[model samples]
Target chain A: MLALGVAFSYTAGWLAPSRLSAQRIVDALQQNAGWHPGYRRNHAKGVCVSGYFESNGAAAAYSVARVFAQGRTPVIGRLAIPGGNPAAPDDSSPVRSLALRFDLPGGEQWRTGMNNMPVFVVATPQAFYEQLLAARPDPATHKPDPARLAAFFAAHPETGPFLAWAKTTRPSASFATQSYYGLDAFYFIDAAGRKHPVRWRVAPETADHTDAPAGPPSKDDLTDDLDRRLAQGPLRWHLLVTLGAPEDPTNDATRVWPAERPTIDAGTLVIEHAQDQASGPCRDVNYDPTVLPHGIAISDDPLLAARASAYADSYRRRTGEEAHVPGSAPAADATKASQP
Target chain B: MNTHPAFHPLARVLHWTMAVLILAMLFIGVGMVSTVSSKHTWLLAIHKPLGIAILVLAIIRLGVRLRFRAPPLPADMPASMQWVAHASHWVLYALMFAMPLIGWAMLSAGGYPVTILHGWPLPPLVPAHGALFGWLRLAHGVLAYVFFLAILGHMGAALYHGLIRRDDVLPSMSFPRREPSPPQMSDAPATTQASAVGTALPEQPPEAQPAGDPASPGQGDAG
Candidate 1:
């Protein structure tokens, strides 16, 4: 038995730990985007904010979740750029992420990580892993191998729509001016036990109306823009829940429901303050997409489980490192004053 | 003078070393699953190799245990308490071996490379399959809780013997402490032959000889 144990310990690499495992995916991510210790494996650059979602009770028609019960639900959130590099230039990545955790009454919580894009790039975790590999830069050339990307694009035709969307859309001027979409579909359970498939987005009240002062883009442009805007006053976004038809694809995040789907203006999300993530209340939050409240249930989207796993892995890695936020002391007093 | 027989020196060394390693492994495992920060990588980096180390050490410890007899329980201790002690020790040995083996197999089933020291990736113990990975992961988690509870029980029992009972059970595994000699026996051997012989012969009654026996003081201090 001891010999068998020793033999098992010495043997190396009969099969690759599959790319599908969360660890493998995270490993690939760290490799593709040079590792940044003490930061998120993805969406490394972020600013924390505290706010509240003032529900108008309109969403109670679709689901029985307490957040829609005509009252204020406290929220802590992070605004981030999608990449592993914490100091990546603001304009380098087109995607922006909004991760929020709603602290409801009775100690229940709803956490979500949303993107500014209307649809996600891939339908399944496997494709996302392959995409990461294809996007990995060659050590010699310092660029993604064009042949590998071409082959990936050829094999995964579902990526075409996302690519087209990315090509047509420009990065928003400020984090506050973008509409964040919960790309994955979820089932809203009503009091009667009926499940309604729905997709949600928080549309900024000031989108398209605010003009960014034209200037050369700095590395911290987006973060600076947010700070300048928040200093003046609070910013608000309208929570819109789009009800899905029976034919809508709940499992695939890459597919979009028709624009004409009946939408409900559930609430207004008011961001009262912004703080540095290093010492912000949102620093330790995972923002796992599957962390739902009593009324919300995860759909069959494979990406949801994969995301929860990956986020968990990323959280574990960063928390183990020293709490080193690149640039400034935590504004503890300012953040404390903002709490309700 | 102390008259109780003590464990072999190597057995005591293995016990303390494993005690520290197992405690660290439990904390690392808990931290690894609960967070998504960059530290997750660092914790996992430590957790994988630490597990394998424990496995190797456990095997060696088992070998030592089989080669040498442990100090018998105090003669006055109840039969039920002795049975519990023996059963718990076996359970701990089983967990020490099972935890790492299951962790390795789980990683293998998940298709994750069981890399140690950030390099040397161990071969998969099983082929990659999602369902199997899921089950193995569940088992690893559940067993970890059981392992933790068992450890708490073991520590509690050790402390009970040391503090409340004030018996030789705890001292048997503890580092040997020096004892003052009795002035009356100027030329006698420092330790009683019966105490020394008791360790080498498992069938002997636990050293319950009267105090001031010439061999007792030396046997108590022998490493």
Candidate 2:
């Protein structure tokens, strides 16, 4: 029976205990190829399983960065027309909308999916209602009238920053292939757990390009790119997290965080698997700024404040209830407020 | 009158097992995030297999759902709510399957081995050092949070039906019935990103100190 136990354990990859034995496994896995029969890399350094080098989406066991901070997770995201128009071409618009959802660790969640625009076309819910209404195409023309956009522009001057990005940043059908913004005043903790407000952006390994397809692009381009890219290689993103002191105006997100401050190496991201954009993950996920990681709390951005309410409403609209996520354990919360 | 037969026996088994595993997974997730890298020696050893277990169980549960039909909703439930319930349940199912797969995919993208029980390393599903891990991680973080909200509503609704409304919803999914009307996938819903968002070991807040402003939007550090 004991012999059977050892054999079963061996077959199951369970190695016997002993500092040396474990080390030997680590050493073997770490070997040029690795130590244990197949697992650890007995590399030059030995069986060092550093998160930085060898991540498994379980970074939560170490630090909080929603992406890596938890156990294995599944996700889905949706791209759609921002206006009431369900058929809006992906191209005719400057801003794109992404609805995202994550199933994470410890039953705690922070869900909020937003748009390409840092700030919304309007701040107040009332104003947003108006924007949604005005975004309608002219009855006479039955097409999206420039007048509607002009009026929305005239109504919400705060839309200036995002509008600037829209005007400056070229829109591509391959948006999933483009950079995505947290677009709010987001806080990120460094290795030491200190907080900094950042406007996070994901720079795609595959740069956005529309040179190939002629005519303004089509909304389907983003989908085309996603499929094409998935077939081709892995999708990579660089997580550039910005830092700012509390009350810093740049943290407002109405204005950009100055180019001067340095964004710590919070992490890198790679996505090998992807689901259909029209899937439930994208539709149900909420990217509200209010759902930021600890150490990375919300800034006093008005956009974020509106987002707090709007996103919850959005989730309810889709899911039929107020989101009551059993929030992840607070990160250094007492350590922050009490320490000061 | 078979008043409590909405969930199948197989569903019940998968559901309870998943519940225990999921809750344990969530707690383990919390513990994992709170720990620092240098200090997290043992907690991590558990995270891998547990995650692998979730993945396997989710696959099995999905297969069962596909192979066996889920008992229909109570006859009197609202059509829209029924649709919503179906949609939510499937979304949860999709997430369950994807999260663990993403973990494995991430490792494959990073060129790392995702061994089951530290045994035979699964062949790389994708290539090594592929950029997908980064985007997959982002997508994973984004969706995990949303699922958290979904679970909250699910639990609250079950409690509402079970308590306030005094409906049989709770018992149907709860115990002592032996009716096997358990949630097919079990309520093993947890958040990977939630803990990451909350329990990040505080880093030294970089004092507005400028270091060449690569921090500008669109201008990332070029390696």
- Per-candidate clash tally: 25, 86
- Output the number of the lDDT-best candidate: 1
What would the TM-score be for candidate 2 when compared with the true structure? 0.42
lDDT of 2 by residue, B4-69 (tens): 333445655777687667655544443333322211224444656777888888878766655554
Candidate 1 on A1-340: residue-level lDDT in tens? 2342233223211133332466667777777777666678889899999999999999997788888899999999999998787888888877898998887775466888999998999998889988988988777786778999889989998888788888987766689889999999999988898999999999998757644437767888888889998999999999999999999999999889998999999999999999998778777677887666778888888787778778766664565443342321223332111110
Q: Worst ten-residue run, lDDT, model 2 chain A?
A: A42-51
True C-alpha contacts between chains kept, each model in order: 0.02, 0.00
**lDDT of model 2, residue B206:** 29
Residue A261 of model 1: what lDDT? 95
Off by over 4 Å in 2: A1-75, A79-81, A97-104, A112-130, A143-152, A189-194, A209-212, A215-219, A245-247, A277-280, A320-340, B1-223
TM-score of chain B of 1: 0.78
